[model samples]
Target: MKNNKPKYNSIIDAAVQVIAENGYHASQVSKIAKKAGVADGTIYLYFKNKEDILISLFQQKMGQFTEKIEHEIASKQNAKDKLLSMISMHFKQLAADHQLAIVTQLELRQSNKDLRLKINDVLKGYLAIIDDIVEEGQQDGTFRSDLDLRLVRQMIFGTLDETVTNWVMKEQKYDLMKQSKEVHELLVFGLSGNTHP
Candidate 1:
C-alpha cells in the first residue's frame, strides 16, 4: 500500500506541518508538496485528496503514538504505573511537538462530519490502550472493580483529551508533562476515596 513508500511518509509529515502552519482550510496540495520536496502531482499517487492526506497523517502519527505508549507501559508491572505511563506519554509527546499540537488539537477538530468519523476511526487504537489499562486495573484491584468500564474509559480519555486541548489553547504556556502525575492521581484514586494501588 501507500504506507510502504518513502514519498507517502514524506507527504504525511509535510501535511502535518503545512496543515498546522496554514490551518487545514488554507493548506493547499502544492504547499504540502513543496514542503515535502515533491511535485504536486506526486501527492495524488499517494493520497486521493487533501482530506485523505489529513486522515493518513492522523493514522501515521497515532500509530506511532500508540506503539510508543504500549512499549512504555509494558515495562510496568501494575496497572497504576501503566496508566501513569500512558498519561505521561500522551502529554509529553504533544508537548514536544508544537506544530503537531496545533494540527491535532485545533485543525483536526475542524474537519467535516465524515472526516471526523474517519479521524475517530483512527483513534480506536489509542482508546484500546486505555481500555486494556482500565480492565487490568479492575481485575487486579488497583482500580475500583465496581466502576463501569465504558464510563471509566470515557472519563480517562476525556480528561486527558481536554487537558491537552486546554494546554494547546493556552499556547502551551505551562508544562503539560507536569500535570501528568496529578491527573494520574485523580484518575486512579478519584476525587473522594481511599487511595488504591
Candidate 2:
C-alpha cells in the first residue's frame, strides 16, 4: 500500500511536526508538503485530505509507541513489572518528545466527532496491550480476579493519559518521568484486592 512507501513516511513525520507547531486548523497541505520536501500534489497521491494525513500520522506514531511498550514489557517476568515498565516508558517517551506530547495531548483532541472516532479505532491496538497485561495479572493473582478487565484497562490507560495531559498543560514545568514509580504504585494498589490502607 501507499503507507509502505518512503514518501508516505516522510509526509507522516512532517505532518506531526507541522500540526504540532501550527495547530491542525492552521496547518496547510502545502506546508506539510514543503516540510516533507515533496510536491503539494504528491501529498494527494497518498492521503485523501488533511484529515487523512492527521489520522495516518497518529496511526503511525501510536502504532510504534504501542510496539515499543509491548517489547519493553515482554522482558519483565510478571504482570506488575510489566505494568511498571509500561508506565515508565509511556512517561519517558512523551517527556522525551515535546512536539509529540503537544500533538497527542492537545491537537489530537480538537478533532471532530468522525475524526475522533477514527482516532479511537487506532487506539484499540494500544488498549489491547493493556488488556493483555490486566488479564495476565488477574490470572496470576497480581490483580484482583473480581475486578472488571475493561475498567482496569481504562484506569491504567486513563491514569497514564491524564498524567501526560497534566504535564502538557503545565508546559512541562516539572519532571514527568519522575512520577512513573508513584503512578505505577497507585495503579497496582488499585488493582489489588487488599483493603489495607
Candidate 3:
C-alpha cells in the first residue's frame, strides 16, 4: 500500500538517521519529518506515531538485511560456508552503514518493552535463517548431532549481536568485517577447537 510510495522510504531512512543522531527519546516526529523533507502531517499519513515509525523502520531495514544475507549465502555449497557467508554479510551490512548500526545496536535497545517485543518479532525472520543453517550443518554432520537447536541458534545470533554491540560501543574503532572469519571459526569450532567426529 503506502510502502510503495517514495515518501514512505524517505521517512523510514530519515527516521533511522534522526533517531541515530538524536537518540530515540530525544527524536521528535517533527525532526523526522524535516529530515525526510516532508510536512509533519505527512508522517502520520504513513505512521500512527513515533513508535510505529520505529517498528516500521526496523521491519524495513531488517527485511532488506535478511534478504541480502539470504542472497549471499545462497551460492555457498556447504553449511559451514553458508554460515560464514551469513556472518560476513551481517558484518558487511552494518559496517557499511554507521547510522543504521547505531540505530540498531544502541537506540533500538532503549525502547519500551512493547516496542522491544515488536522489534523482536521483526528479528524472527533473521533468526529463522540462522536456524536453517544450523539444521543444515547438523543434517550433514558438519555440526555435532547432539547440539541443541534452540541453544545453538541463540549462541550464533547472540555472538553476532554482541559483537556488533561491542563494535558500536567502542565507536567502531576497528574493522568489523575483518572479524567475520574469526567469529565464524569461533562459532564453528568452539573454544576447544574441536571438529565434528
Candidate 4:
C-alpha cells in the first residue's frame, strides 16, 4: 500500500459509491473525485475513464471474493459443506460491502452489453467454484450425476443473485446470511438425488 495507491483506491471506492448512488451514466469523473476527497485529475491518473473504473472495480472486488471463498471452502471436509459455505460467504461478503453491492447489483448491469460481457469474464472464476463443488458432489454420490453441471451452475448463481437483489430492494432489513442458508437448502433440494427425504 503506497501513499498514492490509497488515494487511487479511494477514487475507486468513490467510483463504486457514485455509480451506486447515481446511475452509471449519471456518474462523472469529477463526481467520483469529489466523493473521494481528491482533485479530478487524481481519478484520471488511476483510471483511464469511467468505463475503466467499472471494469477495474469488478475485477478487483470479484477477484478478492473468489479468493476468499476458495480459501474458506478449502477447510471444509465435504462437498456439501464446501458448497454451503460458499453460498453463505457470497451473500455475507456483499451484504457487508453495501456500496460495492449496490454498484455490482444495480449500476454495473446498466452499462452497455459489451462491458457486461467483459464483466462476465471476471465472473467466471466464481462460477467455476460452484461447478467444481457440484462435480465433487456428483463424484461423492451426494448430488445427481444426470443433472447438467452448467445448468446447476446457473441455478446457484441465479438464485443467490435474485436473493441478494431482493434483499437490496427491501432496504436490507433482514439478515442476508439467513437467507443464504435457505437459498443453499433450496439448491441442495433440487440438486441432490435423495427423493424420499
Find the candidate with the highest TM-score and give its number. Answer: 3
- Tell me, by lDDT, which candidate is best: 3
Over 4 Å off in model 1, which ranges?
A: 195-197
The ten-residue window of minimal lDDT in model 2 covers: 188-197
Point out the higher-scoring one by TM-score: 2 or 3. 3
- CA deviation > 4 Å runs, candidate 2: 194-197
Q: What is the lDDT of candidate 2?
A: 0.91
Q: Please provide, for model 2 over 112-164, each residue's C-alpha lDDT reduced to its tens digit, 9 standing for 90 to 100.
A: 99999999999999999899988998899888899888888888999999999
Candidate 1, residue 165: how far the Cα is off, in Å? 1.0
Model 4, 1-197: lDDT tens per residue? Answer: 32248787787788888988888998988999899999988777778789988998898889989999999999998888998899989998999988788887887775488898989999999999999999999999889899998889998899888888888878788888888766777788898956431
Residue pairs that clash (backbone atoms under 3 angstroms), model 2: none
TM-score each candidate.
0.95, 0.95, 0.96, 0.93
- Candidate 3 is scored at a TM of 0.96
Worst 10-residue lDDT window for candidate 3 reads: 188-197
If candidate 4 were superposed on the true structure by all CA atoms, what would the RMSD be? 2.1
Give the per-residue Cα lDDT of candidate 3 at 62: 98
Segments of candidate 4 deviating more than 4 angstroms: 1-4, 195-197
| CA displacement after TM-score superposition, residue 72 of candidate 3 (Å) | 0.8
